[model samples]
Target: MQTAQRKSLTMLRWMMVASLALPVALFLIAGYVSYGTTYEEADREIRRSLDVVHEHALKVFETIDRSLSEIDEIVRDLTDADIKAREQVLHARLRQLSDALPQLKSAWVFDAHGRPLVNSMLYPAPDMSFLDRDYFDAHVKESVGTFIGATLTPRSPYQGAAFFSISRRRQSDDGSFTGIIQTSVLPDYFEHFYARIGRAPGSYFALRRFDGLVLARFPVTERSAGPAPHDIPAMAADTDRLVTETSPLDAIERRVGYQRLAGYPVYVSAGLDTATIRNRWLGTMSRHLIFGIPATVLLIIFLTLARRRTEHFYVEAARRLEAEDALKHGQRMEALGQLTGGVAHDFNNLLTVIRASADLLRRPNLPDERRQRYIDAISDTVARASKLTSQLLAFARRQTLKPEVFDIGRSVVALRDMTKTLVGSRIEVVTSVPPEPCYVNADAGQFETALINMAVNARDAMAGQGLLSIAVAPASDLPTPVAPHHRPPLGYVAIAVQDTGIGIPQDQFSRIFEPFFTTKTIGHGTGLGLSQVFGFAKQSGGEIGVTSEVGRGATFTLYLPRVAPSHEPRSEAAGHAAPIGGRGMSVLVVEDNIDVGRSATEALAELGYLTTLVDNARDALEELVGGASRFDVVFTDVVMPGMTGLELAEEIRRLDLNIPVVLASGYSHVLAQQGTNGFELLRKPYSIEELSRVLHKVAPVPHHRAPPVAPNSEVR
Candidate 1:
């Protein structure tokens, strides 16, 4: 047993360590994988921001290219040398042409003779010729390139601080050198373009033309100034090497994007400080984390709970295995019980023969001194055998009982006295019996055994040196009806045994009553004591309950039904006249088994009665109806093949009308309904005396109840 327990403990330890380590390792690996993925995603998000800034710079360059193309078309058309056609085209046409392009401030044609043909101003024209001007020379010499002049407020024609341009040698359909045309473009056009690029808050854009002029300054008004604040030459040169980079802006330690406009000689620096961008990202990321964190936490919590449930399943499996083992152990004890009960039954019959034979031997034929010695030996032997039978019945739980109403309080007080000897001097035994009688109808001997068993258990629990308490009172809480045949709210007697000892653990409490279940050393206990108590309580229609704490002590309480009225005890009819010598009354005994039928007939023959025995109920009925067998009483076993004894008894009542029928069986559960006449029942395993007594009680002669008459005085 110790080896088995050590093996169980070792398995449990390995299970516990596995239960703890496995989930921790798995979750740590999972968390590491998740953190790595999140970090990579954060890095990808930074790269995406760089791509957006690069795209914005390309948009700025496209705006400038579109504006330049519009102005070039107007200059090429103005050199047509059709002066009359230009004026007749109306000022509306000229204004429409100028407003058609956002970047070209105003446009007019000045012929090779140096006269203004059209202007995009209020009723005015600029007196200028681009025939020898540097813009004209540059345009004629280059024919396709734009040459932006110096960064100064323009003279005369379309004023308001602009940069002028020229285009010449425009060919008609005949390819003639018509004239040189000049136009001015405003810096506001570039300013408006930068505004469309849309800088971030507290940021700006700068557009630089190829000739080193800061064409526009967003968020700064400097229309009269020539060159802008920052060096445009270096910025424009960096156009090819203008990689978008995040750098600290100004004196403040903040991060922003700086990039040269793609496909053009201009610089666009539009960015927000790192703090501002971080604050915005932080708000968004905080909201994401707020949701993600709880979801992750909930997932972890669910995983932990699942782990706990797995542990519980293993624990439950162990408990079920223990329960199955306990069940097999109890079955073995029950088998032992059947064996002991069979032995006791046969031994009792032998003892009965010995006792009767011994009585018969003590006659006057033997010597007087020898007769006394033989009688003494027989008496001692019989007494010893009686003790042996008592032990057998205790083990088998099949003792004959004379249950009677008794006060449990009286019983507890007596037990307290007995426990003092059992528990020794070091242990204190206390008892509390209620003032009211806690009465139960149970066999006194078995009740004493139950009390002794509980006391012994308490003694063992205390390790020979603590207090044992026995309390007797009315049961407080009882279960409701478990079945239809339950008795009413009759009072119950509670016998509680409590010990200040090594207490039982909560998990092991249910197994304590199982037979052969023990936490004791070998040779110390047979493990039948509590099982006997359990069987006794069940046989007496009672319940047992237990309560315990780990280090504190334990208490077991037995609840038995309070004594109620029932059949009175049968007093032996000691002396009677020869039983009227049995005047040959016919008795029909019906039994299926031959041994039992022959036994009945032989026992009946000893009473000098005529008997007809049959093996089947159908034959018995036929014999009775044939008028050959006039039976005074028909004795039959209740359970038979052809028909039950009750059916045979019913048939006998219908045919013979007044014949008394006796029903006998090993089972008491098959008794007929009470108050049914013409039939009486007898339980099995009866002797001649029991048979004779039941026959006399159930089918007595009619004259047997008559009062005794004086023999001499007669009927007077």
Candidate 2:
């Protein structure tokens, strides 16, 4: 019995030891993986910083080259006598050029013997000689196309400021060096630019010649503008793209990128302090250690206690889980309620417009002008309601899209007036579109709706006062994928809406697209606007993205797949014309709703068409097949209780009936599921003019000389 008890105690001790060692091993592995990830991210950030610096440096150099070229052209045209005669005019021109370019400290013309012929500042030309200047020496010996020389302080008139000369050699028609046109650029100009771009304390950028002579450096020290150290690393010499080493000037480790400026012998380099990189990594690691150590310790303690009171812990955990599930259910219910309430509110407003317009139209003594106004008001309200329904369908991912290839840039330009009206007068609307068209294949209506939605969102963000800009351009790179399985295509056309407003908070990024998620006060917004835009972009084979800084602004970009130029779709304006009158045309109307069927039948009859109405497709088919009724056209709704209108149309084709069919619907999942088979589709709440036009398109009737028939008699 004593042996058995001792063995049991030993096993228990081993089990406890195993439990403690497991968490430590796992945590250490996790820490290693996390640290490696952070290091790689830091390296990538360094490369990005280098690219930005390189671009800025290239711009500065280009400006210098252009200034020198202009000076060379002006000097080459003038003879020595012309320069002496027109000296004042020449000086005025140089001063103008200098004033235009803040980077240019001064401009001067030098003779082959290195004497200043004309200076940009002051008349009578202050006597100056560039005999010892490298730029002048190079030009005098041989024609130097363009050369940047060492830093020098000017003499007398231009004293007290350090300037580097960028010189262009001027030649006569005989191909002999005439003179050098030189422009002095202030090093402080570049220093300020570098300072703006470099955010970190120790981070710096430098411009150096091919031979390692430093021209400019940020955090300017006396040694920085001098020659580079003899022990300069190979990365800073020649055309080495990027390297990580200890900087010779500051004796600090840095990761640097260097590039030779295009058309110039000098190189530009940007470096980030290795100490800053390491400090960032250390801070991240410290945070993990701070939370992770205690969490691990607590986990171990909990596991030990859980093993002893397993049943009790399980009961408590089950209760907590139940409570969490209940909370989640409540949250879901709230979201659903919000969505429904928003939809209802918008629909109610639309109904108010329609109801008020109809009530005003019923007034007996209304003038012809007032009558027309009420009629137009009702028509506009119906169109608005249709748009609302379309947006709701888009949010539900069931909108029946009529995709066509069109120029996106042109389309956005066309919306400028409408966008201005939507956002109102307080906000300024600006548009930037390329002169060349960028074509994309998408539903034009939905695309326009998306733009309108974005503009409204921007207006709201600005609180009714700000600048709203809409820009369309071809994207160089694919947009970031919004979903894990989404693989972006090779190219896209981006429509971006930018605003100066109170920007979005970082924490709301993930929830911005949720159906009912919003930051606006209740009754101020519905929050389905962005959701519709998101769904439309995805369903149209594209993606949307947003970038915002807390106090700066926000830009929302919609990326649509680009289409070939040859496939430019026809515009809607081209399809509309004066409505043609129907003269005793026969028609078959099939609709499921009683009120809709009655109204349609009466309207067609009033328009001089003999009409027959049925509630379902089967009845309409029976009437067509069995009755002695001759029909010129068949008009039907897309969705119904039995045998959908699309199917009915298909059957008519199968039966070889020589009749045209027009399908109409408010919102049809069927139209989205099974596309319309070449049948003309008229969206619901269509105007009488639209109805007449579509009928004339499918089946035409000549004018009748007989008197107008009564509506009740015309309906059969």
Candidate 3:
């Protein structure tokens, strides 16, 4: 083990050394590659600049050549007899050509004797003897095509300034040379044109003849326009269009591009200073090194630290995973505890009332009025317990829903009395609703319960003495309040409940909607109130929001999706007499719990229904299939042993039995999960009045005396 450990340590040290050395090797390779690329880019840019300058220079030379050709045509047509007559015409044309071209210095016609016949600059004509000019001598000897003269200081009309001439041989109709028609261009013309090309300060552009005599140079001086030095390389090399050369005039190193102008003996060259290119490349390389060095150093430091902390990292990661598991488990347990405690507390209260009432009735001396009162109290307490369970189911999103489109404004107005009662006389209740009805699709009872919950919360916050206001409006008319991780509805009908009370704090906002998360002291609140409201909003495809500032007031708004108005009014079952009895109609009670089954059967019997109780869905199915007894309605619990009530209902349907099925459940996911399959559902802990109403609606006996009320009627 000790030998293995030594070898492992040596291997790790080698690996670390290799890791550090690899980046350095890569850095050196990258630097070399980058330098090559930078050099190529700089060379490309210089060539591109040279191309632009060459194009401009080409245009200048072509213009000059075209003007010379035009002059030759005019001179070719001139005859001795018509020379005096055409002199004025010829001079005017030459002056027009010179004026049109900024580069042309002067235009003139010379006779075979080398004497100027007409000059464009001197109006009437000057006594210019051009026989001494090199261009004049060339035209007199071998005057055939055009000839570009070397740069020289010309006398007379040119003002003794250095200029070059492009001369074309003028021939008579017999093809005999008459004289040369020449145009002179000063070096300043090229200087001004080159300046516009916008090269670097040290850069240069030059026009030179085929024999290496420079005709024009940008930043021109007397010294720049001269013969090329013997030491300079040949400018017209076929393979060397681009080259690096030191200027004879300034001794500055430059990258030069050369191109010979077409139809002329002159060549144009554009150069870029090599020093400038080198400086730019160095700047870029320096920047890369400046940033890369520190980054490489930091990487080495990080690797060293990472090796040192490897064990610690593993330990911390394991600890984090354990902590996360514990936190999630704690959350699940807390939620479960809150739900169980709330349900237990409510059911225990109802049991206490029922137990007390039964004990009172057991007394032999109990008065008839007192006995009836105790029974009534027991029934009312059971009804309250049923309502509490319904609210809890709704909060859990498991309750069966009967959604309808109704006017939200009218619903708020209908709840005015109820809101007043909930807040009590100490708090003033106010309501504001638009005259125009706003419609929404939702379970009306659940919506009312949510609204009442909001009002009650508001009342508690106000200490039951502040003002409580309920308003109904279109969602478009209200400013939507922001909530963390909640999406606002597009189109909705907003119902806002506002109160003048001690507002909720910012720290408790996220937890306000959690189950059993109440700000009130224990026994004063169940904390499921807001939870119910929150669940109702989400299940209805909407959202809920709250806005509160401490010491000011609080407002809770419920936004429900808006629906198009329907012409038909919603028919409600309230304000009608409920059916009192089942009229001896038979019901099949299928429950897994023996006590629940017996109690349900007894309740149905009390409602004038003959109920046959069964312990499970299988027993109930056996009786129905054997035809031992026929039931008017198949009233069965949703969850049962052997087979489920939903499956039993389906079997009854397959049997073609005309009996209606009513399902009941204390709390089951069947209604929320698999759906109701069109069967009516009655929540557990139902009252006798509710059972009677359901029985009469499903199967009413002809002999019954009481008239049937709406199935949805409540004993509010």
Candidate 4:
């Protein structure tokens, strides 16, 4: 569980990190894309406006050229003296052309002498020297197609607004420069048209000569600026281009698109201020951040809260588990204390009896009858000690068992008379058995002992006056709490011992199964009866439960898995078998304890058997397999250091030795779980009669009796 909790917490932490990290990553990507998109849109819009200006400027230049060409054609064959003579007619035609075109301020004709011949405003034009003007001198010096001059404020006729002159050179038929046809073009004409093209604040529009000079501008600023803040691109080429530079008029940075009028020596430019472009980008990002940051923050907050809550949950769970462990530890300690005290008290009582009997027997010249009685008393005390130890082993669930299938209903019914006599004639013993047999597989002796224990406990509860009911019936299964996890829910036979006596209390319910816990006052009950019942039920793949109420009868139910009816255990003969003489047959005794080995060999000799003894299984095997004296049977202890008696038996079986192997053990975990593996078993603390019987059952019968080699025995 702790590992799983760690994994869960680690997952939550990673999610919290991602909750913040992922959105930031997405926002950075979005910002980069939107930044590019904003500038590109401004560039596209600026280029479009410049395209409109380009087309319009081209038409204006072409129209003025056409007008100059027509005037030139009219005076092509006329001489200068002839042109002056017809000045009134030529002036009227010029005035007519000027009045028709709104962009033209006036038109004039100048002679090759750098003198104006006639003008559209005045019939006989003012005698002004044209050589001083770049427009007039440029045609006289070079053979140019058309000359677009720098910006100027015209003399007096239309001098308020700035306009530049568009002039065409007049050539005679011999290709000599005669004069220039000059026209004053209105800059307001282009400015007003450009003003109509929509632009945001700090934007600009302009028409410039091909020589990088500003000719006309919208929202015109004073030309008082210092050096340009950044470099200007060479937009004088025939192709259009985009440039980012400071505006010369305002010293503000702007992105400009320059388009040259097709087939003309003029260019039109449109600009959008960088600040305005950035504002547009900021607006888009502002909208995104307005939603994105809050959402990301909320997600982060949610993850943080989840992390905190998960930490709290695990902390509380750990504390609860710790508390539970402490509780179980305290309970086990309490049970151990009770078990130690009870075991000491019981053993001390048995020892006192044995000591007293031995002391009585040590008197001088004791009577034969009294001596016999003392010896019997000592033997009985020893038996009691052995039984106490057996109960302890049973409570620990380590005692060996001989399990067989038997009808449980008949078994309990047969115990009715004995229970009545034991519980006493005062307490009524009742038996309830189902008509159909309920069979179970368990140790018959333990089952009988458990029943009797419960019966005796009921007698004590009632103080020998209440009814004791013993019932056997078919039980399907036990409660979920009563069943162990490793055991499956199988068909069961339930034996219930109900007593109408002082009932068990609820507070003592859990301790009832603990070793040496009894309700009867101390010195009145030994307190191992119910514990034996608990251990027996568990070892036999079953469960035991109790239900009781104060002042009401209590019921202890033992649930054992039911089995198919089998052959019942037949009664054995009362007489013991005559001791077989083992004069010819030899026995191999394998015991780990030195005292046990000596005692076993001596006992075999008393039983008229020749014996060989060894402390461990290895030497026993050598004696049986390769020793000079061949043995007819093998006896070995089950638990030893290197090789267990069971393993030694199996090895002998593999050797295919015809000798029988008898296994002996007091308590072994292997024996409790897996059983004897089909070998004759002598339980620990066995007497000579029991050992002799087991050996007789497994070993060959000896026919010849011989005098045994013993220092104290008399030969017959």
Identify the candidate with maximal TM-score: 2
For residues 545-599, write the lDDT of model 3, one tens digit per residue.
Answer: 8999998889999988787877777756522255477666767777777777777
Which residues of candidate 4, in runs, are more than 4 Å off? 1-333, 481-490, 568-584, 627-629, 703-716
CA-lDDT, candidates in order: 0.60, 0.78, 0.75, 0.79
Quantify how close model 1 is to the true structure by its C-alpha RMSD in Å. Answer: 44.8
Q: Determine which window of 10 residues in candidate 4 has minimal summed lDDT.
A: 224-233
Query: Residue 203: error of model 2 in Å?
Result: 56
Q: In model 2, how large is the Cα lDDT of residue 429?
A: 98
Ranking the candidates on TM-score from highest down gives: 2, 4, 3, 1
TM-scores for all candidates: the values are: 0.35, 0.53, 0.51, 0.52
- Give one digit per residue, the lDDT tens place, for model 2 in 28-51: 776678777766775676567667
Q: What are the runs in model 2 whose C-alpha is more than 4 Å off?
A: 1-311, 353-377, 420-429, 481-490, 566-579, 626-629, 702-716
Candidate ranking under lDDT, highest first, comes to 4, 2, 3, 1
- Candidate 1 worst ten-residue window by lDDT: 706-715
- Writing each residue's lDDT as its tens digit, candidate 4 over 120-142 gives 87868767676766787688867
Candidate 2 TM-score, true structure as reference: 0.53
The count of backbone overlaps in candidate 4 is: 0
Q: How many pairs of residues collide in each model?
A: 1, 0, 0, 0
TM-score of 4: 0.52
